[model samples]
Target: MADAPLNGIRIVELAGIGPGPFAGMMLADHGAEVIRIDRPGRGGITIDAKDPLLRSRRSVALDLKKPEAIAAVRRIVGQADGLIEGFRPGVTERLGLGPDVLLADNPRLVYGRMTGWGQTGPMAHEPGHDINYLAISGALHAFGRAGEKPTPPINMVADFGGGGMMLAFGMLAALLHVQRTGEGQVVDAAMTDGSALLMSMIWGFRGMGRWSDRRGENLLDTGAHFYDTFECRDGKWISLGAIEPQFYAEFRAVMGLDAPEWDRQMDPRSWGPLKAELERRFREKTRDEWVAAFAGHEVCFAPVLGFDDALADPHNRARGTFVEAGGVTQPAPAPRYSASATVAPTMAGERDDAGVLRDLGFAPQEIAALGH
Candidate 1:
C-alpha cells in the first residue's frame, strides 16, 4: 500500500547467502524497494531465487570485478536509504564499496554489514556458518539431551534469529537515526554478537543459579517430561509444555491420573517414573487422539507437524500464515497491522539497468550507456 510504513524507503542489497537475503526480504515485505545486486557469471549456493528469503525484491547482475560495476553500485547507494551486505569484514572495502566510501556519497544512507564473527574480532576474517557461529556464541551449548552432546537447532537460532533478523533491525534503527539526525552510520550486525544476545535469558537464569550449563538439564530443555515431545502409537509426535501447577493439574485431570503417588509433580525422582508411565500411556493412542483429548484443556499441547501439515493447519489457514506466490508456497510477511496488509511476494531475477539509471534522473543517452 502507498501508506505502508516503509513505503517510500529504498534499499540496495549485495546478494549473499542465508541471513543477507532474509533481511532484505523482511524490509521488502514491509514496503522497502529492495534491489539486489547479483554478481554476474557467479555460481550461487542455490540458483532458486523463488526461495522465500529472496522474495519481494528486484535484482540486477553486476560484476564488481569491473570498475563500471563499482560505479553502478555507488550510484544506487547514493539513491538508497539503506544497503545490506553479508561479506567478510574487508571484502566490500576491497571492492571500493565500503561504508566510508558509500556514506561519503550518501550521508543519510544506512550502511548495514552482516558478518559471522564481527568486523574486528580475531576470527573476523575467517570463514564460518551458522553452526560455527552458534558454537562460539554459547547458545548451542544449551540444547539437546542431558547426557548427549550439544545439538544445534538447524541454523534457525543463529542464522535467521540472530544474523538476518538482527541485521534487519539494525538497518531500520540506522534509518530512523538518519531521519532524526541526518547522520548515516555503518551497522555492524554480527551473528556471534547477536547469538550471544539471544542467550540473554539463559544467562540470566544461570546468573540467578536457576539454570545449569549442562545441555538439556534446564526447565525449558527436555529435562522435564512435561516440556518435551513424545512419540505416539502411530509413530507421530506430540509436544507438551504444562509447566505451571494449574496447567499440569488440568493435564493430569484430563489424562485421568487419579493416583495419589503422581501428585508430587516437582520431585525429580518422580519425573523419571512419570515420564515412563506417560510414554506408555501416550503409546496407547495416536497423535491425533492425543490432540483431541487435549483440545479444550490448557495443557500447552500441540501435535508436531511437518512443513506441509503446517501449511494446511486450521490456524495457519485462518491467519494466512503460508501463502502461494510466484509459484512458490512460503510463509507470508509477519507482524500484521491494522492497515497496509503485506503484499504478495514476487519472482525476482530480472535485470533492469536502464530503468534503474532512469530512476536516478539520467538522460536517455546516459541510461543507454548504463548497459547490462
Candidate 2:
C-alpha cells in the first residue's frame, strides 16, 4: 500500500463492456480508487463471482434511469479526480452525465470516454465489434496468409490495444493537463484512432516500399522464413525470429547449415527454398530437442506455450508475472517502477457504498440521501 503509485487518485467508472472494464482494471491495479457503477440487480451478463478481471475495484449498483441515481452519480463525480466510461456518442448525454454537465460542476475532473468509432465520425453511431473496428483501420487486412482473408487476432488488437489502452492514455494525458493548468477536459478515446495510430510503423513501411499491403508478404508478417513458427517432430510449435543477419547466421549454424547453400541468407529468391529446407530440418527434431540445441545460442527461439504452460514457464514464474486473486489466476501488474510499482489487491466485491462515501469526505447523512 505504501508503494501504490496511484493511491490518492479517485476514478468513477460507468460500467460497460470490454474495454471500459479493462481500462478501469488498469487504473485500479495501479492503486487508484475506482468505483464501478453497476446496473441495478443482476442484469445483463453477470460476472462470475471469482472473475479476476473484475477484481481490485468496488461496485455501486445504480439504476441511472432514475433521477435519484443520476443525482448520486453527479455527487460522486463532484469529488472525483476522473471518470471513465465506454458508451456510444449520445448515451451519456441522455443519462444526464455528459461532459458539459460534469465539467461545469467539477472543473478539474478528467472525463474519459472510450468508444469504437469515436464521437463525431459517420460510424460513431454504428454498431460494431473488434473485428469490424480492425477491418476499418486496415489492421485486419495485414494479418493472414497470402491470398487469404485475414483472421482476427483474438480481439487483442481492437478491444485492448485500441480501446482500453487508448482510454488509459487519454486519461493520463488529461490528468497531467489538469494538474498543471487547473482545468479538466474530456478525453475522447476512439478505437479507430488508437488502432490506426498503432499501425503507423506499418504504414511507414508500406510508404517506403519496405512492406507490402498484401497479407503475408511483409518480413514481419511471417512471410520470411526467419520470422515464423515451425512445427517440430513432437507436433509442438516453435517460433523463430532471427531478423538480423548475425542472428540468422547463428540460427543457421545451430541448424547445421554451414555450407555454400546456406550462405544465401539474404537472397530474396532463395528464401522460399531455404525456408522449406529449414522446415524439413525442424520437423526432424522434437520441440524440446530444438530448444536444447539452441539453449545458449542467439537463435531467438521460444516454444509456443499455451495459457497454462505460460504460467509455469521458468522465466515467467521467476518474475511473478502471474498471480492468484479471487481464486483465479491472471496477469500481474506491469511496466514496473522501482519507486512506485503497482501491486494487485485481493478482492472481488464492491466496497459498501456508505463506506466509500465517507472516504470521499461525505458525511453519513449525505451517504443515506444517495439511496433515496
Candidate 3:
C-alpha cells in the first residue's frame, strides 16, 4: 500500500500477549512494516499463523535468552522507526535490550512499553490482567447492574481498547515527535491509566452531579427505560437509546405507547414500572419484527446481535467492517482514511529468519553466527 498513511514507517514488535500484539496489528494494518520478534517455539496467546492479531506482519523467531539473539534484535531496531514491548518494568533491562541500549544504538527510535500498572508505580512489577487493571482504574465499578457484582466486559475495555489502542496512539505520537525533532522517547502506556482515561466522560458526569456511583443508576447505564436492552418474543434482544425528548416522543409514537404514565420519562421513580411494562410490551414481538417496526425511525434502536449475526449484518457488510483472512473471519482495519487507503490484512505466515536479518542489513557471517 504505497498510499497508506504509515507506508514508510517500520515497527519492531517484541512479541507478547494481549495489547502488545494488538498494537502491532493496528500498525501493520495501516502499512507499517511491523517485524514481530517471536520467542523460539513459543507463540504466546497468538498460537498460530491464523491468529487475527498476528496478521499483516512478518515474524522472526529468536530465543531472547541468548545474547546473540539480543544482538540481532538491536541490529533490527537500529534501522527501525519504533519498537513495541509489553513486559514487566525491568524485564527488558535485564535482557540488555532496554530503551537505553536501543536508543543509544538508534537515536531516532520510538520505544513503546505496554503494561497494566505503568513503569514507576508500586504495582508496576506485579502481574495483572485486564480485569485487575480496570478494577484499580475505577472503571470496572461502573460496569454492571445496580445491585449485582461488577461484570467484566471480557477484557475488551482495558486490554484492546485502552491498552493496545493507547499504545498505538502513543507510538504514533512519539514517532511524529521523532520526525519533527530528530529525537526519540519512550512511551509508557499503562492499561490502568488508559482505562481511567477512557472514563473521562463519566468522571465529567460525576463532577457535574449527573452521574451516580451506583453502577446501573446512570443515564447511559441501563438506568433509563429508553436506554436499555429488552428481550423479544423470540428470545433475542433489541436495544433502545432514545435519550432526547424528540427521540423519546418518536419512540413512544412508533411503539404506540399511549399510556399516560409513559409521560414521566425522566422520573426515576417511574423507571422500574415503566421498564417492566416495556419488557412485557417488547416481549410481544420478535426481535426481527421490532427491527422492522423501528426501521427508518429516529429512535436509536438496534438489534443486540451476536458475533455471527454482526458479521452477517447488512450495514457491516456494506462497510466491509469484517473480512476473511486465512479462512478465518475477523474485523477489518478501522478508522478508514479518505486519502491514504489502508492495506488489506494478510494472515501471519512462517518465520523468515534469514530474510528478516538480511532486510535489517545484517551481514551473511553475522546472520550465520546468530543462527536462526
Candidate 4:
C-alpha cells in the first residue's frame, strides 16, 4: 500500500537480531521510515537480503568502533523520532550512544530498549533467550500436556509476541504521549513482563479458581475432549473447539456420539473416556473427510494445517494474509485499516552508506571524509 500511516515519521533502528529487528519491521510495515544501522561488511554474519524480517527499511553500515561512526549515529539520532536497541543494559552506554547522551541531544527522542529480563533486576545483566523469559513468566509452564514436560511455542510467546510486539505498542503509546506533552520517555520493553501480561486471561481464570496449574489440564490446553486435536485415518489431524453446551452438542452430533456417556460434557472424569473414544472414532476417517462432514455444522472445526498447507488454505488466500514479494512468499502486513494503508516489505540492498548519510543531513564532503 502507498502513503502508509506513519508516512513522514523516522525511526533509527540499531540493527540487532530477534526482537529489535522485529520491532523495526513492524514500524516500517506500518509506514515509518526505519533506518537500520548495520555493521560494515558481513562482519562475520552472512547477509540474507531475502529475509522477510529485514523488510521495509533502509540500511547504512557503520563501524561503531570508529569515532566518526559514533558521531554519524549521533547526527542521525538528532533527526529521528525514535531509536530502538536490544542489547545488554550497559552496552549502549559504553558505545557512547546511551539514553542520557541521545536524549540530551534530542529531548523528544523515544528511546526503546527491548530485553529478556529487562534493564534491571538480578537477572538483567545475564544473557538469555525466549525460552528463558517464558519459563520465568509462568507462560511455558502453562503449555503442553499434563504429564509431559513444558513445551516452548517455538519462540512465539517471548520473542515476537512478548518482546517485539510489546515494544512496538509501548513505542506508539509513548509517541502519543510525546505528541501531547512534547516530553519523550524511555520505553523499557521486557519479554518477561510481556509474557506475563499476555497471560492476563489465564491469570484471571486462576484467580477465579477456574484454572489448573498442571500443564494442559486447563480448559483451553487439551484437557477437554471437545477442545483438542484428533488424529485421523490418513495420519493428518483436525482440531475441535466446541466449548459451549450448544456447540458441544453439535460436535457430538457430527461425531455420531449419541451415547449417554457423552452427556457428561463438562465433567473432568468424563474427559479421559471421551478423549479415548474420540481417538478411536477419528481414526475411522481421513482428516479431509471429517472436515467435509462437519463443513456446515456449528461444531467449530478446522483441519490441522502445516506451513505449506496453510499457504494454500482458502481462508488465508481469500484474505490475502500472505503474499509473494522479492521472489519470496511471506506473511503480509497485518491488523489492517480502512483509512491507513499498510506498506509492502522492502529488501535490504547493497547499502549506499554515503547516500544514507546525505539523507541524514550529512554533507557530501563529510560523507567522503568518513571513509565511505
How well does candidate 3 score on lDDT at residue 263?
A: 96
Residue pairs with clashing backbones, model 3: none
Per-residue lDDT of model 4, residues 1-104, tens digit only: 44788888899999888898889889999999999888778742325778888887888888898889899899999999999999899999999999999999
Tens-digit per-residue lDDT, 133-195, candidate 2:
999999989888777889988989889998898898789888989889999999998888888
Per-candidate alpha-carbon RMSD to the true structure: 2.1, 2.1, 1.7, 1.6
* Cα deviation of 212, candidate 3, in Å: 0.8
Ranking by lDDT: 3, 4, 1, 2
Error of 3 at 316 (Å): 0.6
What candidate 1 gets wrong by more than 4 Å, as runs, is 42-47, 363-370
Q: How well does each candidate superpose onto the true structure, as a TM-score?
A: 0.95, 0.94, 0.97, 0.97
lDDT of each: 0.86, 0.84, 0.91, 0.90
TM-score-best of 1 and 4 = 4
Deviating ranges (above 4 Å) for candidate 2: 43-46, 361-372
Instruction: Compute the lDDT of residue 52 as modeled in candidate 3.
Output: 92
- As a TM-score, model 2 comes out at 0.94
lDDT of 2: 0.84
**Model 4: how far residue 240 lies from native, Å:** 1.0
What shift in Å separates residue 335 of candidate 2 from its native position after superposition?
A: 1.3
Candidate 4 runs further than 4 Å off: 43-46
